[model samples]
Target: MQTYARRLALVLAFTLLPLSGCKRTHQIIHHATSSEPDYTPQILADITPGHIDGMKYPDFTDIQAQVNNLYDMRDVDALWVKGGKPTAQADAMLQEFSNAMQRGLRPEDYDASRWDERVANLKSPEGAALFDVALTVNAIRYLNDLHEGRTNPAHFTFGVKGYNEKKIDAVTILNTQIIDASDVTAAVDAAEPQSLQYKALKKGLKQYLDLVPQDHSDPLPEMNPNAKSIAITAGYPALQSLQQKLTLLGDYSGDANATASSADLTEALKHFQHRHGLNEDGKLGSATIDALNTPLTARVTQIVDTMERWRWLNDDYQNAAIIVNLPEFELRAFEGTGNDHHEVFRMNVVDGKSDDDTHHTPVIADQMKYLVFRPYWNVPPSIARKEIIPHMQKQPGYLGAKNYETVDLKGNVVSPNIAAIDKGTQMVRQKAGTSNSLGLVKFMFPNPFNVYLHDTNEKALFTRTRRDYSHGCVRLQDPPKMANWLLRDNSKWDEDSIADAMNDGQDNKTVLLPKPIPVVVFYGTAWSDDGEMHFFRDMYGYDDDLEKTLNGGRPYPQKPMKAVTEKDA
Candidate 1:
């Protein structure tokens, strides 16, 4: 009995040992799979201390890349002292990374020669990679600062441990990819996704990806009446391609392959024209072809550049704000209630000079507080000197005709008869009226430019393909709607009240908002909301400057001007 009992105990020990070994092996595997960083890498997410469930977090591979991508802008001393608060740097890096990822990657975009020299001379791939990493990080940091309304002093340095902190040149990496259309076309033909051309085009197009309203209208032009449609179709190699591009641009809403007869083609062309806000005639004119010949890659670049500017904004999703998209000639009131999707209010808008020289309106804030219906025009010095002054010199009665009040340095409105007295010094203002420079109503938000929204006598500007007719101030397509919306809840000023105020026709007719709504007058050549891309022309030539900044060009001496704080005004 004792021998049998001893055998049983030996068997049990062996079995127990294997089970213990299996348990240890399982523990090792679990640990290997379970470790996850407690923080997000690219965009800063407020992190709290707790065991971060691996499944709940972003993919580790993506997270690793994202962490590598974070742009730390602070001096090492400040960074270390701040416990590596990655907010500034992270914002910058995310802008660049998002821009790059969407825009497309190109081999030529990187300075392969410089990168190779570093790798060979340094004899350290790790070191070379580190420098590359540092460049990207710093670039991103600068972008974040701009986005957060810290526009000036574009660059920052990080103090490293022990050694004199290394200065990572942020500008060097910023303007790396202002790609031309030809390169992108070649890349597309070659199916080279990794080319710089591809990156530029891709990033550019990503801007327009958004969910548009079902009522989103397209105005297409007519086919040429002078030329035979069939013959022209045969001659144009990119006819189908152009059609596809137009469809992407919101030209044709019907079937992509639906054949159009000559008349149908003309109608289709007219449709395209209408969508583009061009003449509705069904003929391919110079203007129409020029628009058609515009490269997809260029459009993409504009879009991406515009989105980059958006990255520089205060991204408080909870804020109730008005966003004016200049190219689209539209304004939107976006209200975020800490929910999944934001509530939007959209209206048609009249933008600045459509001429290539004067189209761009600078991206700005949404601190609208009041409205001044039938406001008097305090003519700007530039306009007065350029437009009114020259004309006034030619005709002395021009001030009277234009209802302008010439003011002396003493701030009193001088009579038109005394224009000869003020003479060359030139101080003039247009009086408030229907025919006055400021139409029926003027919405006032105090700004440095003295620019604001108002009704326009030149309503024709709103109907054109390009609506940049104003000196600087925006002209609303629907002024009455704006008035009603602004004064809806206020008992003192309902829509009727606003109408009465308009009839009153008094300057400085200040009507306060029950709750002041924020308005963002932004210019984005490309913007994406809900995944469809919207494209616009780059009127300001700002994108080139931005492109240069991104590609290691000298830092923009005039970095984004620092944002005005509440204390500032």
Candidate 2:
């Protein structure tokens, strides 16, 4: 029992159940020609307090109650074992465990290859009981990992709110989906997101894995950090290495020894840059060099990490949803089911600066409640204290010069004196106009992050490839277009009215939408579009943080397996 328990903990950092059933001794029933053994007592004893049950409190309790509930409903009979052997459902689950990598999971985490030996050595009823318990533990863990990510998003405090599932549902799903299914693998796959975006990433995983070479020790030539750009002239020093790397990465199909003037090589460089969210100027710049230096295996890990984050999402953003891919600095609005979700419209966006801790655009799952047109930019207290107040103190007339005001707590405009602004007794707000910091419009949502999507006065910032210049709020490229889409349920507001409201002289006009449009400020450095995988720079170092948090515990053991002999069996 302790051996199986240790194996589970070494694999995924969690396991075991506190089952809710009987202490009745193992029973066997015989008919005229057949007999089936009841291993319920064996199951209960295997997951007992100090044996295979090494998980902590509630998690242990929930799974235990659920598994016990399964046997309780079956008159304390084991669900995965029949006649002292694993049932067909158990075999189906073993296949799911073996193909776990296909879904961006590690097969070893589920004891994939090790299962066969475990089953072959299950020559005794007690061994069969342990095997059954281990199977249940792995199955539940796989389902949870595939549904809600292996690494906890809360570990990094990204503010990504996820839907929590009760542990009891773990066995409920197994009973219905696995135990009563013809295609067990299909049932297991159905546990994940059923969206096209998820499917694209999943398919791209295989394609990207195929691009990895037998060995990746030989990397491209190190580029000069100070060099602005390297021209691909004839016999360029890094040209051969560049061509070989890109060719192996599937961005270049021609020969590695192709000339520097080879259009294929140039186009391949541009294509690689495009996929990597880099400036595709068809030149070897330092940024491009950094991306090229990133190992293919690293990119594969990024894809898997992206897949894990996708599992954190529920059905909220699937229909009539707005998604802001933080790494890409892009937004996509969609309104339909996965099969016909073609109503998606995309636009470039400017998110918060990644360099500052407080300036990151928080990852959130919420709803856009309304639109505020020609809105007043109520400056935050931190900004006022750090930036505006200092400027106001230096230039006494700076307040009136920019149509900014000092407003008291009672929602009344106060005297624009520098004394009150310096004292922090009053808040600051920029008047609604063309020169306002928020430009002409803002979308409001109910979130604790105090962030929103809005029009920005710094429109020129959008033209840059890496736009992260805001103070945590997201800046939209086309707020009027977003307004029109949000107001589609209302007949009074068209694109013309939307444009008029944003451009008019009206100060802070609010328009409540008919319904809440689900919005998610999501962060994924790797994404898939049109069946092509795309990678982006980790703007806020979240990828590194998530990776570290995931690897912070004991790693899986890589011990060789000795086949079970007849004597061992």
Q: Which candidate achieves the best TM-score against the true structure?
A: 2
* lDDT tens digits by residue: candidate 2, 368-432: 88888898888877687778878887887888899888899787988875566667678889999
Question: Model 1 reaches what TM-score against the true structure?
Answer: 0.59
- Winning model by lDDT: 2
Give the per-residue lDDT digits (tens) of candidate 1, residues 458-514: 777666666666766788777877888777676676677677677675665777777
Model 1, residue 134: C-alpha shift (Å): 4.8
What lDDT score belongs to each candidate, Candidate 1 first? 0.48, 0.73
What does the lDDT come to for candidate 1?
0.48
Error of 1 at 113 (Å): 11
Q: In model 2, what are the clashing residue pairs, if there are any?
A: 18-64, 19-64
